[model samples]
Target: MATLLYGPQHDPIHIEDRALAHLKIVIATKLRRNETFTLSWKHPEAEPGGRSTIWIHPSIPLRFVFDEPEAPQINVRWVEELMHTANSSGGIMLVDEVLDIGEIERQH
Candidate 1:
């Protein structure tokens, strides 16, 4: 399954091999321009809080291995689902769902 890190803004960021690479470039560009972004991920089955969110600056190094498992697919339907959940939170809530990264790339 592909691992995806969502933002507090409810924006779904799909990351894969080349997509991850492209994202790194985009992140670098944004950081170079002094932009900041918030990112979140699940804590895995062993964790207590269930999930965690962090504000990622431009300095974080991102690396993806081709041999790693592919991420799950993320589609409009998934976005709708997330929106539904986010809206119900009363306040803005961020979530990270595993997505098939290839799906996003294929659609493009």
Candidate 2:
């Protein structure tokens, strides 16, 4: 299965097809602007409020995998929707959930 890696909030934020597209855009824009930030969210696969982070770099690949056929066709429209929801709900997007901890710190 594809790894999503997103959380620590009321709702779960799995890296589904559309979510990944929005993340690609956000990260691309941030990298284009030479800006870095952190975001977090909860994943349904984990307990409620379980959190994690990822470090986003411009050099990171944004290409979708072969199994993700629908991802190739999705557009920024979904990203826009996701942004609106996240912004209004105070939720984190895909890359937003990525953080650099400097070390493999354990979670409680």
**lDDT scores in order:** 0.45, 0.48
lDDT of 1 at 36: 64
lDDT of 2 by residue, 1-108 (tens): 234432332232355564565566655556687655544545656446666555444454434323365655444555565445444434444433332354226431
lDDT of 1 by residue, 3-101 (tens): 344334444333344334334444455567776664444444544556555555655544334435654333444454444443342311334433567
Query: Candidate 1: deviation at residue 105, Å?
Result: 22
Quote the positional error of residue 20 for candidate 1 in Å. Answer: 9.1
Native-referenced Cα lDDT, model 2:
0.48
Give me the displacement of residue 18 in model 2, in angstroms.
Answer: 1.8
In order of appearance, the predictions have TM-scores of 0.34, 0.45
